[model samples]
Target: MPQTLKTLGPKAAADLDGDLMSDAGGFSIDQLMELAGLSVSQAVYNVHPPSAGNNGGDGLVAARHLYFYGYTPVVYYPKPTKKPIYDGLVKQLNNLHIRFDNETPFDKLAGESDLIVDALFGFSFQPPVREPFDQAIAVMEKGVKPVLAVDTPSSWHVEDGPQNEGLGSKYMPDYLISLTAAKPNVGHFKGKKHFIGGRFLGEDVAKKYNLNIPEYKGLDQIVEVPVDVKVEKL
Candidate 1:
């Protein structure tokens, strides 16, 4: 049988996420987020343990780990969340001198970089996008640069894919790093590659929610889920 992974809608995803971060879950939010970021970095490097390593912004975490993996990443964090987690992630990037071109135009960014990791809007983003981010998504839709989204593409709904049957619906990343488990919207993910990563989901969590996630081989933090496999509700 082909390898299978369960797909969760946003509500289920949110609930499961809460459980993973709860005292009963025995996971610190930062710790789990670190694993998530590491998993994403590993996926980007396309290697397992003993090979390459391990986000806050999710993008921030990915950027830091990618730097450790020997990739020169230039970031575009126009508006940053003021949370301590984000600050800490930024500090790590600053120590490494990872470029954060908040002033550079999106089209220019598209041309200058090899890959655009779209962490502009994470899983919680609602459609009819606000300020600069709206412009960012627009540029990605039209640009030629390859994109690797951290979770859902900027304006896409967690369960329904794109909010508008407009540009967002048309835009797809070159790669998508599905955190923890694949979200239902991934069925609409028209990216060139899809990867599932994250190491904090316990057997209890999965069993309670009936999440049929993949088993990470050995010490690997990520697993390549062949995009051809059909996605179904859990």
Candidate 2:
């Protein structure tokens, strides 16, 4: 039997996004990036076991350096400018004084860090990545360490899943922070990819159509325009 992709229910989507966006003192991109950093950091722990001693932590053996890959210049290219995660993301890294680099050669990024945060692509990418980005993606696929894709990794025909009418599958993320309410059936047609089952969205927004980082209340609010709902006059 073919492996199946799980559906994200409304409550589940809200729960995921809410957990990230909701803060007592309103929302900010810095907060979101901080949450994301922590999330990726934890994911690091999940993949690599804690060190034998030194209080059972990874014990600094795993490199602290984290690299971000993406087209920062045009985070919202072809789309209207809006609040983006890129700014807060880099700022958060700087605040933490984390050794982070951006838009480097994919191989260099792959080799330099123990973990890679794949922010190279977002939901905005409708057409396939051509040329340099494609080459870069190919390199990313070769890294030995675990990859934490911000949105989803770039892949072929991922958007053209069997269930385009059902749920659309962009690129698959090893782990996904859905940003806002998880789109129902959004990733149902992931071909042969294996995604760990925990995707979250921002709770503040009702939907998450654009990548703009809006004030949220957890991952439990509407963040974007809901894609065309399958009409069912019941």
Candidate 3:
């Protein structure tokens, strides 16, 4: 029998926010970030188990997860002084004794990576990409390595998806690992694979938001989302 797929519009997807970072429940941001990072690491390992290169917000956390699982990961980021977030991320990396290089250029790092994690931006990023990140994203987009985007693809509009349709192929990710819930921008995801992680949302919250998300059967903390399916009401 043919499987009946499920789909959610961008708006509905956006409304489904279960990220532990959000005040949706009692979980701390750090706790949620850890879970989110672990999910991403496992997804990448499942498909492409090799040394990785990561950039952006969740990249550092993801990198740490990879290291814990005995994978080699090279993280690229602006100096901690450039972004306040990097300050804590760097400390965490140092504390865990994970390998990273914030000074090397993206082009040079791109060559070393077997897979790239586009954690350069989250669901909150607005377009135009700005400065160093813009250049870095361009380099990664042009690279031959497959990319797994964390949350949303870098440089893509959160609500509208990729702004430049012409460059869609260039910037599109091979895989997307959405945390908590799928973001609206994921409706624009051109990836071959999409997975939902951060399965900690309570039933009440899910109902209040009308998330309409499916259950993660068995011991799965992450589940694949089929494309072009009919919407199923939760």
lDDT by residue (tens digit), candidate 3, 30-117 = 6766677777887787667644333322377778877767677777776344565657877888888666676777777777767788
Which residue runs does candidate 2 get wrong by more than 4 Å?
A: 1-37, 49-92, 95-97, 100-104, 130-132, 156-234
The TM-score between candidate 1 and the true structure equals: 0.89
Residue 141's C-alpha lDDT in candidate 1?
A: 82
Q: Where does the lowest 10-residue lDDT sum fall in candidate 1? A: 49-58
- Which lDDT value does model 2 have at 171? 37
On the 0 to 100 scale, the lDDT of residue 98 in model 2 is: 48
lDDT of 1 at 166: 69
Q: What is the C-alpha lDDT of each candidate?
A: 0.75, 0.37, 0.67
Q: Once model 2 is optimally superposed onto the true structure by TM-score, how far is the C-alpha of residue 58 displaced, in angstroms?
A: 20
| Highest-lDDT candidate | 1
Winning model by TM-score: 1
Q: Whole-model lDDT for model 1 versus the true structure?
A: 0.75
